[model samples]
Target chain A: MHFTSEPRLADGVLEREFTLGEIPGILWTPESASASAPVPLVLLGHPPLGLHKMYPRLVARAQRAAADGFAAATIELPGSGERPRSATADQARADLRRAREAGEPVDEEIVDRLVLPLVDKSVPEWQDALDALLSLPEIEGPVGYSGGVISIGIRLAVVEPRISAAVLFAGTVVPRALFEEARQVTIPLHVLLQWDDEANDRQAALALFDAFGSKEKTLHANMGGHTGVPQFAGDAAARFLARHLK
Target chain B: MHFTSEPRLADGVLEREFTLGEIPGILWTPESASASAPVPLVLLGHPPLGLHKMYPRLVARAQRAAADGFAAATIELPGSGERPRSATADQARADLRRAREAGEPVDEEIVDRLVLPLVDKSVPEWQDALDALLSLPEIEGPVGYSGGVISIGIRLAVVEPRISAAVLFAGTVVPRALFEEARQVTIPLHVLLQWDDEANDRQAALALFDAFGSKEKTLHANMGGHTGVPQFAGDAAARFLARHLK
Candidate 1:
């Protein structure tokens, strides 16, 4: 699991078309890696608010992971993130169904049931795209997802054993029970928080960290409102991935 | 329209409940008033975050207006300021329909077509509540509505003849073409904007003001971002209302 700084594909990152059940996703792969070696991959999620396009820092985090020799991909959720906005949640659900059908290599049961309902609940489709991307073949075991407002995805990581690690940033942990379940996760968990966040998403992250009860957990404080993945966090995430994977 | 201070309603502001269509709203009316005949009113509206209960500043603004010899009411949008989370746009629309059906003496057609759709679009429902409140018998002519993110409400005022004067606080304005059909409003308009507002809602306000083609339009700059109605703004709004209405 030693990630080399060399390209596994062409460039440090390569965008390849991937399917999660029926969902189509573009995978960002490190060109320097070996196919035989098990690689740690992450599915970076985004919120609705059309803020998906605004997440340059999260995209860069993926690049940093690739540069550190981990396979990383930023997937646009169905009907979101360079995808057209669906007039209704039903239409978005339909698109999600198609994506689940197409994206076979990943866990469709999670995508169809728990994940879709969460996405339909107005959690934002960009988050769903991350889930779809993680289902791809190039990124199977030991995955992580990151977003400033992605609490549900954290919950997903807790329930799905496939997720070996998770990074929750300025996001809330909901239903309380989700935190209890997340505590059962045998993988490393990290959260980046801002005290200035109005929604107290940072507070929720702390609660989750408390529940997980593992010394492997880390919390980084950055100044700003509840949006954007700070570049300052990129190096920390890289080191954490390297430690956990290799 | 000269707004000045009045006596306390009770120990503080009196919470008034009114039905717009079928939707129920809690209006806080500040008892502080200057014994003036037929006092002008300014209806303060809340955003989708919740009901007026959560917005202390908006309630305070209404109280300040009432103290300035103007009757002020901050009405909670239905289904908002009520629960843990604000109601969705569609829920607000259903409430709008109920408000109209209840025969609350509001502009039902406007509530049904324009205002409801706008609220459903997440533009904010306080303007519609203001519209209904302005049409009430307790309110005198030359009434206005003010708030941050006050663009849609401004557009509603531009089209609806009932709104005689408006003081936008750190507000943004929608495109003039949306309000084009009802162009010739004789009332005065004051837009107070901040430099650090999201996406420069102030600049958007300026663009709308420029397109308005009215000499009476005023744009003032403040030092805050997405601020609640400031105390000093009460005097300024009072002055504007007095100049236009008296």
Candidate 2:
């Protein structure tokens, strides 16, 4: 991991722009954090909207985590943020639109193209970032994951032993294989679902929730579209995270 | 739909090789079927294995449907049977393998490529075939759909008013969007699930089962792999069709 800049944000929170090879990311740390007494870390997974579009939420969530005495972080997903988009990605999007318009099934292979690389490239980058963040004095061992692009969370929860808990947003499309992998996730999970999401498959979300082998998993379903997650839901998720992480 | 050849099979079952546009398919009818008094039809969605590979099961199911007084039929899925494999299909398969090996999510777009065309091309072809078969007066309305390749089953259930009931196999990978489409399905459904399908996402199967808007949808989960549907399960599924079609 390469740290290029470090800028201090509000209330003793420090934001650092860094890169793990080609993947760019940001890490936020609270002022009271130290190596001798490290705080828990929370990794944020941005929604389909690029990181810039989600800056407000990312900042807010990170700030909240920091204020709660935890270090927060996020990484750019493949083809999102400043990452250069590939022909494959563009074609994949066209295919999806065409399939949706035609009311046809998107081929599993095409779906694999869209999600696999992001998961493949993002998880390890996030893990490496975790290593970098944990190397610092302020970030501790136990970790938490939050946000959309749920495949990433599913993977992290399964592979990354340090992640003690996760708060998963249900709006994203989860690949079929992930549901199988989800059975391996044992971390405490708090999943938020928008029951009336125009783009999300409610059954898929519920299936994912059911797929998680986590001993402790809670589903919070609310009425509305993709962005309709209520503040109270977020608060409840935060509390859930606090209980597990803190 | 055009029929090029008709041959008599055992048990007074009649098999006809036909084409809807350029797509090849087969249709079967019982000995008792006649233009004067048509029987109900049952469209079969063959598993990923080619028609030849599934011929025994197809023959058995069609025979059973025939014995139960329903015309049964099946068509080649894209890239299966004698269908010409395209470069896109090969690439999609490679992409799926690469994603799976790397433990990554298949991009949704890529997934669209894999499934959309099959659903788009096949559903209409199936519908056209239905029209032609019904025109013969040997196959009446109130059709039933059975077998795997679930997306086709979903689309048919939602859009085809003629189909009164369906028996859906749960081993196929269903696109997430299909779950939403499934909500529009009001046909009586009997879904067969192999609880331990090695190639299937069990949660996805269950989710699809839950997504069906059918007032009467029954889930039969058996303990086995993709091809592990016991004879009893087939008997049960056949009985389900008999109840609705007969």
Candidate 3:
């Protein structure tokens, strides 16, 4: 891992930009974090939107996590942001867009093509990032994964031993294989679903929530379309991660 | 209304037993509540399990409400507690138990017979208690209705204009009529569902949640059986009430 810049937010959160191999990412740590007193970490996940476009929301979440005494970080997905795009992934996106424009249901095959490969490639990159992040003296384990591309969160929860908990947003087209993988996840989960989300199927979201094998899973379905999650819901999600990670 | 007792809980909350006409009830207020600075009220609802049976759970909820600077109260359901029982209601309960023992789905008519009359008789009693309770010097308006006998909560949320918010437990046999009434409830709501509740219908609960008209509604589904709602859920409900009631 190599650092490109280290800029502090106005509230004194240290925001560092770095790269692990070809993947670029950013990390935010609270001002209080130090070698003698390490903070728990939360990996912020989002839809395959580019990092520059997602920075505002990511930074806001990072700030909230920092306020709750946890460090937050996120890396670019394989086909997103400045990273080189896969031809197949781009073709899948085009198919998804055409389906939406034609007012047709998204094909399951299209969803699998678009998301499965992303999950296959990104989950390992996240673990690699985790390995480097934990090697730092100022960030500690009992890690948490929050936000979406929930398939990745589900994959990580099933495979990654370091993640103690997760706050998953039920907003994506979950590949069918990931639904099967969800049954292997045992960490505590806090899932957020937008009840009237036009971009996703509500029953599918509920089904994914039910497939989880965790003994302590919570689904918070709030009244809103996609992108309309209320403020209190976010607070509740923060509390959930804090309860498990801390 | 008559106050039969005014003992203080260990935390200094004033617990008063009262009766309106012949319906018995209890009211709990924080020590900080007074005529000069009264607190908002939450009308605690429960199954027709009698006050004697529900006292422990009710008082714990009341104490927590008092701790959050709100007065809490509850009135016995029509055929519950030390109150006189109805033969028709008794028959319905018998049928319900017989079906459960027979491993058959509870008939909707049995549900209606078992719950509708209770709702019809209980809602007005709650309203009357609300009137008399609000007339007290230590209690104020901007009320909240919380806990179960969910059909009653649905009715109260629809009819009672004083209730500014509600935290309804989706753990009852909701009458079909109330599902329609749910769409008329525009107040902010927080509905809790025990996802694996042995005695409740999960799909019915989800359908009812979808029917609620509250634009600011939230559905919190947690892993547990009927009586296994995790402690964090209670805290989350308290926070929801505090957000709207205060």
lDDT of 3 by residue, A67-171 (tens): 999999999999889999899999999999999999999999999999999999999999999999999999998899999799999999999999999999999
The local distance difference test score of each candidate is 0.53, 0.79, 0.93
**CAPRI tier of model 2:** incorrect
TM-score ranking of the models: 3, 2, 1
Task: Name model 1 segments beyond 4 Å from true.
Answer: A1-11, A49-55, A82-116, A119-141, A172-177, A213-215, B1-246
- Weakest lDDT window of 10 consecutive positions for candidate 3 chain A: A3-12
**What's the residue-level lDDT of A42 in candidate 1?**
72
Candidate 3 segments exceeding 4 Å error: none
Candidate 2: segments with Cα more than 4 A from true spot: B1-246
Per-model TM-score versus the true fold: 0.37, 0.50, 0.98
Candidate 1 residue lDDT tens string, B1-246: 112233335446655656554455555454543234456767665554555444566656666665565666654443345433333446545665665578553343433443444434433445566566555555566667665435455555655666777766534324334445225444556656554554244434444544443435555433345654334445555666655654
What is candidate 3's CAPRI-style docking category based on DockQ? high
Model 2, C-alpha of A183: deviation from truth (Å) = 0.9
Question: Which scores better on DockQ, 1 or 3?
Answer: 3
Worst 10 residues of 2 chain B by lDDT: B215-224
Clashes of 1: 47
Scanning candidate 1 chain B in windows of ten residues, the lowest lDDT window is B1-10
